[model samples]
Target: MNEQAAEIRKARFGALPERVAFEDMVEEKAVLSANHARDAYDPDGLAVRFSCLAADLGL
Candidate 1:
């Protein structure tokens, strides 16, 4: 992330959780999708992901 974005993130999240880093969050979601695809998938999981993403983007 750029310096300004990192600063914004720190301010919003109060020193962001390690797992909540932007890149890490994307990776986490990809892993979630892959794992779910390999087994049983919960439709709610994708909905929850979209809700979180929308909220984060202030939509």
Candidate 2:
């Protein structure tokens, strides 16, 4: 590529981001107890939702 094109590209998109450490990159969260009373705790809920979505989208 020409120097003018390279300069224009650099001007449009600045410097690339710095590399992040693996530990810093990942988000760590404590696992909640399965016995918690929440609607999402239902095992078949995901499957039922997915099926409904697929039907609606005609997938």
Candidate 3:
């Protein structure tokens, strides 16, 4: 993944350092509640849920 990112960066920019370094970041967790329902669709619930999450995250 780091190599891929470096390649993309190099494509945007012209050059890269002789020794490129990459650091791994802490993986993010899901902010939404996990749903176990099958064949269930709720657009309004999702909208409200995401709205609350966005507010909580100050987005």
Best by TM-score: 2
Q: What is the TM-score of each candidate against the true structure?
A: 0.24, 0.46, 0.25
- Using lDDT as the yardstick, the better of models 1 and 3 is 3
- Is 1 or 2 the stronger prediction by TM-score? 2
For residues 1-59, write the lDDT of model 3, one tens digit per residue: 99999889988996755764453435567898666684478876777657676766889
- Best candidate (score: lDDT): 2
Q: Estimate the lDDT of model 1.
A: 0.67
Lowest summed-lDDT stretch of 10 residues in model 3? 17-26
| Model 1: per-residue Cα lDDT at residue 43 | 76
Q: Report the number of clashing residue pairs per model.
A: 0, 0, 0
Candidate 1: stretches off by over 4 Å: 16-59
**What's the distance in Å from true for residue 43, model 2?**
22
lDDT of each: 0.67, 0.79, 0.72
Candidate 3's displacement at residue 53, Å, is 82
Q: Rank the candidates by lDDT, best first.
A: 2, 3, 1
- Candidates 2 and 3, the one with greater TM-score: 2
At residue 46, give the lDDT of candidate 3: 75
What value does the lDDT take at residue 27 in candidate 3? 59
